[model samples]
Each structure stands twice: as C-alpha cells, then as structure tokens.
Target: MQQYNPDFDYKSAAEEVLAIEIAGLKQLSQHFDTHFVQACQTILNTTGKVVVMGMGKSGHIGKKIAATLASTGTSSFFVHPGEAAHGDLGMIDSNDVVLAISNSGESGEILGLFPVLKRQQVTIISMTGNPSSNMGKLADLHLCIKVPKEACPIELAPTASTTATLVMGDALAMALMRARGFSAEDFALSHPGGALGRKLLLKISDIMHSGTQLPKVTADAPLTEALLEMSEKGLGMTAIVDADNAVIGIFTDGDLRRLLSKRVDIHDTTIGEVMGPNPQVAHSNMLAVDGLNQMQERSISALLIVDDGQLVGALNMHDMLRAGVM
Candidate 1:
C-alpha cells in the first residue's frame, strides 16, 4: 500500500471536482433543443408507466431517476438491463416509455434488450454521451448528456458524465411534474414519511387533545378551576369557553404568573375577568404545519381547534413539536 500523506487536502480536491462537475452541468443548458420538449410530451402522453434501464454507473443514475419520477407524479421503476434478459422484461408494456441510459450509447447489455423492447412497441428514450452510437440512433428520442472532460485528474473516472446524467434526470422529472400540475399534497402522498408529508398531510384533529384531555374552563369558572384544568391536561394554557363550548378567551402560563405577581386572588376572580378574549383559533381540518405557522406568527404557544365556532380540541407548541410539525 502507498504511504498515507498527513496533508493530502482531500476536502479541497473533492470541492474542485464538484465545482468542475457543476460547470459541466451548466453547459448542458445549450443542449435543450426541440427534442427535449418532444421527449417530455411523449412521456406525458403515455398512459402506461415509465421503465428505466441501464448498466453500471448509468444503472445507478437510472434507478434514482426512476424514484424521483415516481415521487414527482410520473409512475416509473428501474429495471436493470442485465436482469431484463433474465425475465424481468415482462415489466414493460406496449404503452410504456423506456428510458435507456448509457454514457457511450453503445452499452451491450442495453442493446441486447432493444430488439425485444422494440417488439413490445415501447418508445425508447435514449440518454447518452455519444448521440451517433447505435443505441442513440435506434431510440425514438435521444438526449445528449455529453461532458467536456472528466473531473478526475487522470480523465478516466466518470465524474462529469454522471453529473450531467443526474442533472438531465432531474430536468426530466421536474418537467413531468410541472406538466402534470403536481401539487405539494400530491408529493406528500408519495413521501408520507418526510417533512413535506408532515406539513401537508397531518391535520389539526389528528394531533390535538380532545374531550377530557382538552384543558378548558367555563367563562364563569373561577381562576383556580382554570389553573387545575391546565395542570391536569399538562398543556401550558387553558381555554375559556361559553355555554356552547365556543372558545371565547385563553389563559396561559404567562397570565397565571402575572396574576400571581399582582397578588390577584384566584379564588375570587372568574376566568372571564382575566382571560384574553378573541383568541386565535383554527379549524380541526387545517394542516398542523399551518397551525404551527399561525402560532409562531401570533407569538403564542397553543391553539384551539373549533368547528362551527365550537371548540373541538386544543394543542400546544410542545405537542406540535413532538409531532414533528414544528
């Protein structure tokens, strides 16, 4: 093994490579001719799913492209060309679009499956470095992903080609996403475990405390009773509601401290006498992330979720935080 250098500056070398790859991707803006639009329109018109196929490093990029397309509203899956020969070709359909990725557009593994794929009547979208190669010529649509040079010092590795391929994949997915009018809610449906899902899919009713768990007091109730409700519910505040259970005011920990500091008698004062009226509230159907934004905007810690002006539930900042909506 070669001797390790204590001052190799690996981080700087990596940054230089990334910078070169980024510059290479910037150059691809010139390659987006009418053919790019045609490719997008063809994929969009296909009633069947998109099938991605590639080999080696190209295969890795193809898999990610498939996943991104799926998440962004285009249904797609990656099928290794090698695996297609071993019976996975059944995944393809006559109406589907096939995207074949190969740096040289002459990958034997991919070319090996072209005849059969063509028989299935699938439209072949080829992405390659050499547009004149056999795979590129045979494709119904060809996307050039050429690079000036590899970022590697020896010009042998695949840094620039891979970056160009990845950028092209992103462009395609984003194009399809916009063409389909895919919304954040649609994206959340596919990424239900991600932050966007928490923002778009989780509702106020799903996480708010309801029934006996809700820290609430009648408008006529004594301040001592309100304090007890807040303590029992473990929320930092209590909601003061009218006879119809409509939230009319709020009393928080800060209010309690102020009342105590002024030597106000909790036993003598009613919740209506000290509560802050016309407090901010939300509907149970509102997104939890929206509720969080509202709370942050109002500089308050809790929110009361009401339906038809009736308090259905309540939640505090800690609850939203615990739910990962904060």
Candidate 2:
C-alpha cells in the first residue's frame, strides 16, 4: 500500500476521478439508441423475472441493477454466473430475460452459459464496453458502456467503466419504470420497510390517537378544562366538539397564548368562544404523509382526524416523528 502524502493535493486528484466518471456517464447517455429501447422492450415483454448475471466487480453492479429493477415494478434478481453454472441455471426459463454485464464483454463464466441459455430460448441483453465481444455478439441485444478512459491512474481498476455500467443499468430501470406506469404506491409495496413505504403506505388511522387517547372538550367547556385535557393528552391541542361529538372547533397552545396576550379570562371563557372554528382536519383513511402535507401547508403542528363530520382521532408532529411517517 502506498503511504499517505500529507502535502499532496488530494482534493484535486479526487476531482479528476469525478471528471472521468462524469465523462463516462455523458458518453453512456449519448449512446442510448434503438438498442436501449429494444432491451427495455425485451425485458418488458418477458413473463418471467429478469435474471441478471455477472462476475467480479460487474457482479456487484449487476446485483444493484437487479434490486433497482425489482423495487421499481420489474421483477428481477441477480445470479452469479459461476453459481448459475453450478445449478442456478435452472432458475432461468424461456420467458425470462437475461441481463449479462461485463466491462470487457468476455466474462468466460457468463459466456460458458450462453449455449445453455440459448437452448432454453431465453432472451439475452448484454451490457459491455465492446459491442463485438463474444458475449455481445452472442446476445440477442447489446448495450455498450464503453467510456473514454478509466479513472484509475494505472488503468487497472474498474472505475469509470463500472460507473458507466451502473448508470446504464439505472437508465434501463427508470425507462422500464416509466413504461410500466409504476406508481409510488407500487414502489411502496415492494419497499415496505423503507422510508418511501412509510410515507406512501402508512395511514392516519395507523398512527393517530383514538378513543380515550384523543383530547377533546365540549363546546360549552371552559378554556381551563381544555388546557387540562391538552396537558394530560400531551398533544398540545384539544378538539372542541358539540353535544353529538362532532368537531366544531379546535384550541391549541397557540390559541391559549393569544388568549393570554388578550388578557382573557380562561376560567370564564367558553371553549367555543375562544376556539378556532373550522380547524384544519383530515380523515382517518388519509395517508399520514398527506396529513403531514396538510399540516405543513397550514403551518400547524397538530391535526385532528375526522370521519363523517365526527371527531375520531388526533395526531401531532411528535406522533408523525414517532411513527416514522415524517
């Protein structure tokens, strides 16, 4: 290993590497032609999953490409070429599409399986730096990722070429995503444990405080009583409802502060007299992320959930934070 040079301009060296990678991506973007469309169409028309195969550093990029395809509505998974030869080739079918990746376009492990894949009549899409390499020539379609040069000083490590390959994979995934009309909800279902899942799949009913957990006071109740309810519930606000439990207004800490500034009598004031009428509210079925948007739009910290004009639940920014809905 080379020793670190304290006086060397590491920032400039890093910027040069970035420049090479950027150039590679720009080159990749320009090469997106009919072959790219054909590859997308081939994958889209496949009834079975996309079976991505590669070796070495290409295998790492292939795995990521497979994952991206799967999460964005295209069913896909990575299979190491060496592993496929051992037995995983059985996982491929006539209806499946194979996405083989190699910078040199000569991965023997992958090329060795070409005959078997052809026998199965599976569609092959090769992504490589050479359009005429054995893998490309044998494939049904070839997508080139040839870059101007590698970012490595010795041109030994897979740097700019790998970056180009990854970007090409991304381009394919996104194009297929648009072609399939994949929505955020669709993406959320595939990523139930991720942040996008929480935002899109989580509903107000899933995280709201319902029943006795909801802070409420009748329209005729005193401001002091509402304050006590707000404190006990710890939501910093209380819904002011009518005799039939329908939401009439809301009173929050901000309301109380304004009342204090006006020197109003908390003990004598009716909740209805001081409450904010027609408060911003959402239905229990609304997406928690939508509720978040409502609060943000109105510049409020809390929201009351209602259904059919009846107060059903309440939630605040703190609840959104705890539920991972923010």
* TM-scores vs. true structure, each candidate: 0.94, 0.93
- Total clashes for model 2: 0
lDDT values for all models: 0.92, 0.93
Give the lowest summed-lDDT range of ten residues in model 1: 191-200
Per-residue lDDT of candidate 1, residues 59-136 (tens digit): 999999999999999989999998899999988989999999999899999999889988988899999999999998
TM for candidate 2 is 0.93
**Could you give candidate 2's per-residue lDDT for residues 1-326 as a string of tens digits?**
98987899999999999999998888787779899999999888888999998899999999999999999999999999998999999999999999999999999999999999999999999999999899889999999999999999999999999999898999999999999999988988888987878999999999999999999999888788889999999999999998888988999999889889999988888888989999999999999999999999999999999999889999999999988887
Q: How accurate is candidate 1 locally (lDDT)?
A: 0.92
Candidate 1 residue pairs that clash: none
Model 2 / residue 26 / CA error / Å? 1.1
- Model 2 accuracy (lDDT, Cα): 0.93
User: For model 1, what is the error of residue 209's alpha carbon versus the real structure, in angstroms, after optimal superposition?
Assistant: 1.7
| Sliding window of 10 residues with minimal summed lDDT for model 2 | 22-31
